[model samples]
Target: MIILYHPRATRPRSRRLPLAVLALAAALEGKEQYEIVDGNLEDDPTARILELIARHKIELLGVSAMPGPQMVAAMETSREIRRLHPHVPICWGGYFPSIYPDAALNARYVDFVVRGQGEDTLLELLDALRGNRSLDSVKGLSYKDMFGLRHDNGERPMKGPDEFPWSPFHRLPVEKYLGPSFFGKRTAVHHASIGCPFNCSFCGVHAAYGNKEKMESPERTVAILTHLVECYGADSVQFYDMNFFLREDHARELCDRMAHLNLRWWCEARVDIMSRYSDETFAAIKRAGCAMIFFGAESGSDWVLEEMQKGITTQQTLEIARRTRQFGIIPEFSFVIGNPNDPDRDTRETLRFIRKIKRINPDSEIIIQHYTPTPQPHDAGGEMYGKIEVPFPDSPAGWAAKEWMNFTLRIDTNAPWLKRRTKKLIDNFEIVVGSRWPTVQDIRAPRWSRIFLQVLSAWRYALHFYNFPFELHLANQFISLRKPKRESL
Candidate 1:
């Protein structure tokens, strides 16, 4: 038996499909007995995973991870696994591994790495383990021979979306991954496309998947979506496309197919796509079950956008937001505030633009994150990485360590008044990073007012609950009521 995993984050509470690992499992289905462990959703995940490995007599473990905090957690899990069982092979795949394969393979905790797409490479690695097959046969793989010189088979072919089979949905922990959805319990994440052609300076995608874009046939997309709705009773979907509208005609055709699925879905796209597509197409998108769309309108300052090589102007972004709202689709944006040129000025401009957006469209949602200046080697040019005196992290371990060290610029606002306030009010208290600003709901408030707030919350929940079809809504409640008793009794 084999075990594939999505390692836990620093402290993960939300789960999603470990798509890469599950894809491998799908390919090896009839050949092996395998189970996927999602550390994010499972309790005491590392311990549970260790227990499962021992019980199943598992020989190899695979983990797929992105960079940043998730990579840190993955290393923590793998280090623990290696400490207890040194002989078991632990393979690394996904974002950090693909871009920094040599560094990943050199790490004490990682025995092997599968770069690019892992489906075929991983299966071949398993074949090598089963019989004494030479590792040299596998493409897009990196590892050290007994002599300890690393070999990376640099020539790997790219495969299209149609080449891989559908996701093994039965292995997913669906209900446990419940995200914020207005109309459903089971949230299905589907993708109609893979890869993006954009060269935004800060993005690592161009390195991971390369610049060529591919779209799954609209028929393939509809079939996958239908399985989610018919098999799991999913009322909502989150499309995992990097740029959902890379090709305007295909996007419209995709939306046309989506209209009959009876699913409420959301997707991410660039602002340039909004201007590129006609208003009627957006109306078609909204009618075809897309209630919300997220745009990467990173900064309100044109200079920062230009610095980031984002390619779109502030006027273009604002106009895109206006058009999105005009079509009755909720417009959401992802923003980054701190950059070198004028950190405080940039943040203020962002807040001003968000305030303006809210004034025009009160329900629009925006998330603003403080920028950390650590550069990615893949996206780093001499103009950016070389010009800065701060050294780039040479290894994944160094990158993880640098996150806590003073190498990157954090808290860039050096204003005296703000510093005093940060020390006195914010820093003195543990304000969680990226948490929503709190509103007043004091326990000391008068009893009647507290009661009113409780009633208001109930009213809001009721509104969300009533959004679904009556029969489907009743079925969900019935299932929920039965689920607890079956377990408790």
Candidate 2:
């Protein structure tokens, strides 16, 4: 038997389907026996894993992890599992391992690191484990040799979603993943594409996927979503693709196909790409029940955007904001402040740009994050951005430390370039703007609480005096104002 584990990543209420584990399970379907153990759904995933091992002749334990809190949980769980069942081979996959294979292997518990798309890599690794293939032949795999030295066997060619079987959703408790969201009473999530073509400096997409993206056929996408709606009663879906709208023709076809699903959806897109989209395509997207589009308007300063290798300009962001509003679809603009070069200037410009976005469309949602650098490979142009002198941790435990964990989440990066005063300004301004225009996506915040916050922050927001929002901070202590960056659709 094999076990696929999804380490706890978010709050239980925020947890959607474990698409990564399910994708691995799809590769194992009919050929091998495996069970999924999601830490998000279980109170004690380690104990449950031990129980499974005791009852079955387990062959391997694969853990899918991302950065931040999930990495912490994964390290702790894997360490305990190794302590109790040292013989069980443990493999790590997903964004964390893909980006930092050495750190993942540095943990004694992780025996293998599956790089890139793991569906094919995992199948090949399993074959190698069964003595049918050689470990060196397994592409997108990292394992220690007899001498205890690590070897990354290079990348595997990526395939489109159609190349693989649909996720083994039947094997999972699908109902448990359906939860309440502003979009619908029972919301589901799906990744209709693999990887992203853009190589943004602040992003780690290229680390795992390279500069490639392959989208599924609209028919295949709609069919799977239809099953979720009919069989699991999922009324809404949030596409987790890095860039959902690639081609205008593709978007038009997808929108046309999904119009009959009657499902409210949200997705991320590039502002420049969407700004170039025809009004008819926007209409189709809106008609298909697209409630919101999350755009990576990385910064307000054109110089900062260029520095980040983000091809979109601030004007394009504003144009999309105006365009999305015209189509009755909310534009959720996310900004990354505190650029390594002249962080103070970057922060001020981004904050001002966010306010400008709001002025263009009062319904626009703003998301702000501190500039947290991720390891990125040099692009085809031989350019790299967001490079810093700080040494990255060489072990999972080092990354799980409080400081690094915060860095992963982009809450407080502790980047050398960012100053305390700049951080405070960002924090205070965030509170004032967020309170002034409470997110429509936040169904949890009470009406009275929203009113109270709006009233308290009105003068501060109007005058742009966001120095010390003491009263807003105190009010937030009693009332949790959910930020768009932290919440899901």
Per-candidate count of clashing residue pairs (backbone under 3 Å): 0, 0
Q: Model 2: residues >4 Å from true position, as ranges?
A: 377-387
Best by TM-score: 2
Per residue, candidate 2 scores C-alpha lDDT tens digits across 1-489 of 999999988898888999999999999999999999999999999999999999998889999988878888899999998999998999999988888888888889999999879999888888899999999999999998768898878679889999999898889899999999889999999998888888688788877886788999999999999999999999999999988999999999999999999999999999889999999999999999999999989899999999988998999999998998899998888888888888999998888888898899999988888877766422212123644555678889999888887787777888778889999999888888988888888788889998998899999988989987889889888888777787641
In candidate 2, position 481 carries an lDDT of: 72
Each candidate: what lDDT? 0.65, 0.88
Measured with C-alpha atoms, the lDDT of residue 136 in candidate 1 is 86
List pairs with backbone clashes in candidate 2.
Answer: none
lDDT by residue for model 1 (1-489), tens = 788878765334335556667778878777788878877777766887788878877767888877666677788888898999887788998877876665577678788888777888888888887776788888878887767787877646667688888877777755556453432456667766656688776666665776777778988989888877787677888887788888788888888988988777778888877777887788889888887777888888888888888888887778777887788877667675655556667666765676566557654656544454433423333134114433445556775675433222233323222333322222211111111211121222344543443343344233423122333333334322111111110
Please list the residue runs of candidate 1 whose C-alpha ends up more than 4 Å from where it truly belongs after superposition: 10-13, 55-59, 130-133, 173-175, 178-180, 342-345, 373-386, 389-489
